[model samples]
Target: MKEGIHPNYREVCFVDLSNGFKFVTRSCANTKEMIEMEDGRKLPLFKLDTSSESHPFYTGTQKSVDTMGGRVEKFRNRFARSVK
Candidate 1:
């Protein structure tokens, strides 16, 4: 609650570069871009390579680890020590 000691926290517009999805939330991130919302209010814009909207895990495009040609089993076998 002290003046001039805390970072400026305000509503920021986050854009998913992969999907062009935009959302507004409060943050203290530093950005040089700005975007005007539908309400005619300008907010700081932050660009992201991947967000929940475009991420493989969130979009259900992620590949199963177990189905990756048994790489996990190969690794375990490669380093596994035999017990005498």
Candidate 2:
């Protein structure tokens, strides 16, 4: 709220690498590169490694972990046989 003490909040564009999706929003984060939007507006292009669009929680494309495999599963099976 002070003079020149607040960060500049401006409209920026975020691009998801995996999905190649683009979205416009306001942000105070800095970026080294930018791109022009369809509205003839210069938007700071921010490259994010992950976003909700491509994330497993939002997209519902999650992979399950198989614990019953490999050396651990074999050891467990052997141990159970020994116990019995």
Candidate 3:
């Protein structure tokens, strides 16, 4: 371990911008924002676009693509003309 060559790792708040979900965890990232917590304390705030709360895979809202049906239809259409 070297001294004065490592980033400052501290507790920071990550806020999900999509659903307004907030959680605190340790991170070494840099931020220029601050947020007040519920207990009248201020912490470094970081905004995120998506997290486990609103992700499609984690929330079970992912849509299955119908590629097999599309491929079968295309194959039938293409070979049907040649066969006829």
Per-candidate count of clashing residue pairs (backbone under 3 Å): 0, 0, 0
Tens-digit lDDT track of model 1 for 1-84 = 788999879999999998899999999999999999999999999999999999999899998868645887778777788633
Error of 2 at 28 (Å): 0.9
> Candidate 1 lDDT (Cα, whole model)?
0.91
Model 1: CA > 4 A from native: 1-4, 68-84
Candidate No. with top lDDT: 3
Ranking by lDDT: 3, 1, 2
Winner by TM-score:
3
- Residue pairs with colliding backbones in model 1 are none
> Number of clashing pairs, model 2?
0
For candidate 2, write residues 1-84 as lDDT tens digits: 579988889999999999889999999989989898888998889998889998997888887677578888788888996775
Model 3 / residue 8 / CA error / Å: 0.6
Candidate 3 TM-score, C-alpha based:
0.78
| Candidate 2 lowest-lDDT run of ten | 63-72
